[model samples]
Target: MSKQKTQPSMIGRMLRHLAGTHAVARRAFPSATLKAIQAGIGEGEKQHRAQVRMIVETSLSLGAVWRGESSRQRAHELFSRYRIWDTEENCGVLVYVNLADHKVEIVADRGVSRVVTRQQWQDVCRAMTAGYAHGAYHESTLQALEQLHVLLAGAMPRDSGDTAGANELSDKPLIL
Candidate 1:
């Protein structure tokens, strides 16, 4: 028989969330790195019709944690809150990193999701997770952006007159 893994205890999860503060996120992604990520997003958008947004959060609130909010749920919330779904082509992608949970989530809008399978999105998340595990925050983020650029370019190439669509969303990386 196959065995299933158990989740961490509630107390353990709470402790981890408490320990992961804004300082922890700042340490992982300094100001320079954040700027680099923003630049990457801008450059990547030039190659595709999709909009990409990244959010790196230190941890969820105690209330959220107590409510058993998973990283994917938090990512979806951020996606809606940030209006990533309001892109012109409806091809916005959100990359969410929850440090305390050690989880990476990719939430793509319907237009992109129709072309990119869930497994493909998970693959991107896995690659980023591997790099994060090794403490390569900047490198991992840029790499994931490159991967998304490739996917978006293939799925929805930017037309010659689509320059206006480039800045549909902000390229800034939100650090929460």
Candidate 2:
């Protein structure tokens, strides 16, 4: 699992340890912003069969810290916990953001992976994190959702007969 900044300095780590708490995430991406993100997900899914989930976490748990958990590792755990890999078409994707580290991790299901390469996902993650570097959280997230929509629409267009496409997963962005 590759990280954005592989070797953060001791002081940077210490500051991030304090700055990236859950409380901070809530403040950064509050209930209203989260709702907007959920809406964006819903809008994006209308044109395709792909399932998209956005998850933002304020910081790592003490246990995770002791376990040496990285953002990429936590994204995998969240992927399973939220069942992002369990969609009907295996086209679910999770856009995970670790607020403290200002890191973004994009995990796609096997079906989506067939069309979208890991390098593409990494590019999107980097783009999203770049926005965060400028404190443009909402703009970055919305843009990422848009990117997912375009990619998924091209990869997995909606079935014509499926009028009332079901939402296999909640559109609500998980704030951890």
**TM-scores for every candidate against the unseen true structure:** 0.92, 0.88
Q: Write the per-residue lDDT of candidate 1 for residues 1-176, one digit (tens) a residue.
A: 12222345777888999999889999999999999999999998998888899999999999999999999999999999999999878888999999999999999999998899888888889989999999999899889889988988898888988675658788999989
* lDDT of predicted model 2: 0.83
User: Candidate 1, clashing residue pairs?
Assistant: none
- Candidate 1, backbone clash total: 0
lDDT of each: 0.90, 0.83
Worst 10 residues of 1 by lDDT: 1-10
lDDT of 1: 0.90
**Best of the candidates, lDDT:** 1
Write candidate 2's Cα lDDT for 1-176 as tens digits.
23546445434655676677667887778777888899999988998998898888887865676567888999999999989999888988999988877789998899998988888788788778888888888888888778878878888888889766889988999887
